[model samples]
Target: MKRFMLTWVLFILCAGTANLSLAQSTVYTPATDLTLVGKVLPTQQVYHRVDTADHPDMPPAVKRLLTNSAGLAVAFKTNSTTISAKWCTSPRTTLSNMTAIAYEGLDLYIKKDGRWQFAGVGRPNGDCTEYTLVRNMAEGEKECLLYLPLYDETTSLEIGVAAGATLQPLNDPFQKRILMYGSSILQGASASRPGMAYPARMSRAAGLNFLNLGLSGSAKMEKAVADMITTIPADAFVLDCVPNSSPDEIRERTAYLVNTIRQHHPKAPIIVIPSTVRENGAFDQEVGKRVQAQNEQIKQEVAKLQRSGVKDLYLLSYPRQLGEDHEGTVDGSHPNDLGFDRMLQQLQPQLLKILRKCDLAGR
Candidate 1:
């Protein structure tokens, strides 16, 4: 009788193991059909260079946003409170003391015009939170749903929240996706907060979904990287890492990367964004002019490819209006909050044009 009981116990254990494996294999259901969902900025303490600034710094949040292999979630924190924040009509960021996490993903809610609805959500694998909603851009109340378990020690925490647009979940009748490749800036440098980053902002503005593959200080345009980019089913891809590459390197890699992506997404539009806010120009030499020139060359080559039957292609020049001289970045290389805004201001129009073209092309 004891032997029979042991055999039954083993069978039950095996069945449980099989069930767990099946559960793990389940793919995360994106709130939207598009892959390029907008990102939300997590809250943290402000880490300012100085104490006597116009802004009054706060302590870090009780619960912190985790940093993965990527060096994100590190740029905005003060001691505790996230320094990157948008000013409300009043002057208060929200407190983020509680935490939750769904094993698969998390959902966001917005109380706009006095109705609560699903705003947007993040993918479980990529470590991105703060989703962009599909609704119109107006004023509203936004809240995040934490999926992961919160630290028991964490208490009420403060977070910087942007008050411009509401985020809603995307539901797709058909599955389509977009991918973006770029540098640290794309990874989100000095954007007041994570959600405030231009890519995240642009994703919201454009109403398209995307996968952000931005690498901080690591956009080498290597063939291996290009090879990896070809493996995805992206409807569109943006190459904006040239600022970090040298002239010759940009010239050499542009065609290869374009061709590589083209091999997979033949009809998808590939937009090339030049470097923004660099070279420390005195408004004379246009120090960033070199990078700008490289972008132009890439644009021309893309044109040439189109003539050779490459389906959809586009170019976004660095607008002279948003030069580094105007805001003068804090590090002379990376843009501070002001510089980021200026860069975004320049990129926004160009981005709109390209996205509109994409929509027209039926992507």
Candidate 2:
């Protein structure tokens, strides 16, 4: 009986050891050996959309589906321990479901050499697509990998988390925050990689934390959605929805979208953007003209509110000039890379003006 009991004990120990080994092999490799004693925590995260419905200025089915919270993330450590983790997702394609219309299989990238490089791809649920587990050092400052994609097409990608760092909060308390609400271009389509999108670029350039709420085709200023926007604390809010909606819808919802954010961020500045370049060549130029008209309407509304004593409302004027694809867009309606640049260039100064206000407001 004693021998049998001993044999059972040995078996149990061996089995446990084997199981642990297997588990260790399957998770993300730790980037550091720093003491990580605290619980793994979730930092700032946004839940917004990118839309392109009002842009009759847009041609057919082209759309970008970027999200505001799609920026950088870092992991923190509490003890000197090695952790193994892996990420999973459901569908690799963008055509998953309704929510996917906003966020699909986009991964975050790391910025290196003044350009963003692909880090790890985003996974949905337990369907982890095996990315090599990289190690990181968290010195409690919460530095994790930036989840943005490379904007410059020629940059090389990097993997592995850094050491002694914690994840950057989606909402930086110190830096000014900019909230971008727009269509798929803001949503990050065909940018060659994640984080390469225009909104992401703007975030990096302006040195501000970004909240991208770019739904692919869902920028209709629904009261419910607008109500959701009110919950976030933003230094400023941007509304760009010409690729998804019609003129009437644009006129109707633009005020509501701006006003909703304004209601919550009463003192926060609001900048409304006219639609970017569209397809259909010169024929589609009319869409740009209509967008200009819509801008006029929005401006008038702001003026009315200003008369009521409201303050700090502005507009971004996008030219009807041809996008990179003078024939108008790579995927029929959406702007190509060159188009994104044009849009970004036009937006930079306007964004700077608003950010300046953010600094003064101390958000």
Candidate 3:
């Protein structure tokens, strides 16, 4: 009788193990298998901003940052009731003002009713993490846009689906690639998630291809970097480097960057944006004065470009873009999600108007 009971218990334990294995089983599709948007150069299989090997002239800072997947996204469709992902991230330290999910996690969006809505997010557990993004819903075909990590390298990414669910590439839904180049704010620092970055937010809001070329502290408009950006054709360009550059650097490199770009893209619209008001500037007198100086210098530079027969060029700045309350930034340097949203609200419509005038956007 005792032997019989022991055999029964063993059988139950084996059954439970088998069930657990089946539950954990999922078929994953590599991100490369899906349509990729928000990329300026698709010259490599790896998800990098630019192929550093090709552009040996690129600044060391740019090359170091090229591997960080800032604005890359996978556009795909799946009929799975449960969606999951497995991604390997590069080694990086934790950001004090940024969430691990925002710096190195995946944000998923689903198209419903002709609009993109937040579906879910995959939180990182380690260097290689797998998390369920969305689950237990009505099973139907859904289009998905998965934004990659903003501040870390996505070494490899694959979208997981329950076995037998069909996954297919989604055609690019956005139009007119718009290149946004600037600092850490543009790189998505301090946002809650990858999709909250201003460029990513603007991309969804305007339904336009906004590629992020944010070089953190390196967007000094170096001639090498300028040459690299001009090599790629864009319908419009957003220069937001004032906050990262010194007054002298801006005076020296701003025109050279614009003129070189004009030589390549004579007709593409160039939109220059001044620095946002730093919250600390209110307390620190030098900070306030420097921001004011930068603001004046950018206006002067844009005016000079416009006067030099630089057609289709404009400087875009709004009163209190970060809100007058000074509650927008995460660290007084980088924008939090609210800071980004305020910046987007002011920049998008004005930008769309200019793009429409240039006939790059739908009127």
Candidate 4:
């Protein structure tokens, strides 16, 4: 009886060892093998450009916003249906019930019948150092777009596929891009998942690349940030910072921001979006007045720019921009997925018009 018991224990231990070995055998391909979009470098130190010598050190605010890997994505093609990833994220936490995956998750999409479709998402396991994004993908070669994290800093990232599967760069033909600068909503606050962020959704819908320069509460139309913006070539520039600015600040700074961008991009369309109507504004008279005043000031400024020969300038109003229901937002201010979808619905038609006017489509 003792000998039989010992043999049973040995068999259990061997089985466990074999299972571990099999799991370890799965191999990963570095995401760098394909194309890392929206960044000059695969391992960029900061999401936005900074003059290190001028500042020498990153300001706490800049560091905080720049580290959030918003608007970055990896594009590739593979024959294997099963896709996976391993990534490390910087230490951070949020009060919102947003999952670690949405805050620090990897979102996957595939081009099907000439349209980008949602595939699957990988959830991080409690500040996990490494996590598998997806596995057992459908077999056959297909183009894929993988969106990076929305609110967390990605320290390292890699893509994995079943061994012996073909992985190559996705030769996307859409080259025209829209560069967006805004506040927390643009930074994807309270988004259920990374790809659900409006800009990502817009990119797939409009067939254009999007460069997100959302700075949380700090998108105050700073001149220094505009200076950085002058460097990237884009088809259109979307300024959506009304939520972070007061009426006075909008009046004082909006012209300079518009002029600065105009100096660099002489003909590219520039869309100035006023703050969206917040949910609480329906009941909070003070909040409603403040938002209305800011929107009016921005409209006046944009009109002035147009009269001053700022060609291709446009203004998107605030009223009913996110829908009248007021159910789109997660809080009174930040949007949930529903809010984002509503924003997208409103923005898409205007964006398509701008793209056509600029002759940026199919180029």
Candidate 5:
């Protein structure tokens, strides 16, 4: 009896050791070695959509949000049976309306059938976290895109895989880069994860790389910010700034914003999308009037620009940007994932139509 008990204990220990050996952490490639997509500037900073050092004069809010990895992702190919990640993010007060995963988490997509599909998500723990993202996959080479946190600054990231699996960089799929400048919605305020942001979704679906430059509530289109935006040589420009701007600000700043970009781009198309009808406008008469006023004023400005020979300028709109049922928003202001999906349904085709005219439509 004593000999049998000792043998059973020894067997348990060996099994535990085998399990540990099966998932060792020896093969991690630092993110610096990978190709980072969805950035507005060429900087090696881990998840910066915009580089603050170059735009010292930008608003403090805009400067801080620049670090948010709204639309940034790392492209790589691996044949690992399991994909894992180790990453550290900045300390932040958890947002009340947003999910912890969406605020500061990693979203993974695997390419299959020539389309990117959501494979897994790296759920964040704290300032630093490590976890196996996906497992139980059949052995085969696969292309992968790992999206960084939407609202937090990622300090470091390392992709890990099973031992002996080959890991290599994948090419940036979207060839035409469009600079997406707007408010918190574009910065991905309430997306369930980073990839659900309208710009990120559009990139995967439309074949145009939309770099997120969302400034939260700070996309007021100041001339200083306009100058900074012009510095990035984007293939196209998208101005979704009206939601955060007042009717007066839109009237005063719209021409400056469009003209400054035109001075730099000359022919690169500029697509201006006015704010959606705030959901609250259904009841609040004053809110309804304000949104209408802003929309009408911006339309006039677009007409003036077109008359002045602003070629390839388009004013894109949808009757129900959120939805006909008015059920798409999270807080009657920002989009939930459903809200974003509904908006993308209309936005994707309208944008491609404008891009088609400029001979810059698809990848």
Candidate 6:
């Protein structure tokens, strides 16, 4: 009798395993129907730069830095009940306090009625190549947008839908583009998810396209970088690189960066944002003073630009933009999801106003 009971348990376990395998075997269709927005070209896998020597406009150093696909996204409308991602990254880990999801995960959003809503996230596998973003989604057709990894440099990526699902490009009417240049925080540092980053949030809230050129601790407002920014045609520009620059650097380079971009885009709105107050500034006087000095220099440069008759120029400042409670950052330096939300709340309104101004100018 005991032997019979053991045999029955084994049979049940085997059947359960078979059922699980069957449940996991959903066929995926190639996501070729989606419109690859945000990128410069259909053949270009990287978003912000061209191959070295291929373009006469940007310096080679700037081109090399642009290889990191920080702000690229794919937009589509689909009737699939399931979604998947097959992607590979050059580096699986960023070696920071930030998680792999913030660096390499695929962030998915759905358009309902007229607004974009966060749908789900696709976590990377152990090798950082394969991910099943969402399986068995709700039925019916919906517009979808998938944001690529913010920090991780993707080597190859592809979206997948359930077999025989209806898929096409999303017909979004908002065409104004906002270009952002800044440091690691703008590059999506310690945010728990990609969509939680301020740029992504602002993009959805304002219904505008954004090109993020945030280099981790490297955005020094260099002339080469400024030249690269000029190559892109955008409706508005946001400069937030004070955290990565010294007071001296800010004083020296801020004016030049503004002037260079203005030379290329005379009428585009340029918004200068000072650095967010760092978390440790309260206890560390030196850090506090350094940040303050940088901010002061930025203000001086913006004032200088305005004095010189640079139109469509604006400045945004908040003493405690991230938050006063010190609960907004992952570390003492980089913003967490809460910090990003706080930033979005403060910045989105100004962005909307800028977009409206651009619309009027266009008309």
Estimate candidate 3's RMSD in Å.
4.3
Using lDDT as the measure, what is the rank order of every candidate, best first? 3, 5, 4, 6, 2, 1
Q: Positional deviation of 239 in candidate 6, in angstroms?
A: 0.8
Estimate TM-scores for all models: 0.53, 0.61, 0.93, 0.88, 0.92, 0.86
Candidate number of the best TM-score: 3
lDDT of 2 by residue, 95-146 (tens): 3211331233334434446544454444333233223333342333222233
Q: With candidate 2 superimposed using the best TM-score fit, by how many Å does residue 313's alpha carbon deviate from the native?
A: 0.4
| Model 5 regions more than 4 Å off | 1-26
Considering only N, C-alpha and C atoms within 3 Å, which residue pairs clash in candidate 6? none
How much is 118 displaced in model 5, in angstroms? 0.5
Candidate 1 stretches greater than 4 Å from native: 1-176, 279-293, 296-300, 321-325, 360-363
Per-residue lDDT value at 97 in model 6? 63
Worst 10 residues of 2 by lDDT: 150-159
Best by lDDT: 3
lDDT of each: 0.47, 0.50, 0.87, 0.76, 0.86, 0.74
Q: 10-129 in candidate 1: lDDT tens per residue?
A: 999997896555334322222222221222222231211112222222112201121111111111101111111111111122223111221222333333454333444433222332
Best-to-worst ranking by TM-score:
3, 5, 4, 6, 2, 1
Candidate 4 Cα misplacement greater than 4 A, ranges:
1-22, 40-59
Candidate 4 residue 86 C-alpha distance from true site, Å: 0.7
Tens digit of lDDT per residue, candidate 3, span 110-129?
99999999999989988888
Candidate 4 residue pairs that clash: 81-137, 81-138, 82-137
Q: Could you tell which candidate, 3 or 5, scores higher by TM-score?
A: 3
- Residue 46, model 4: lDDT of 42
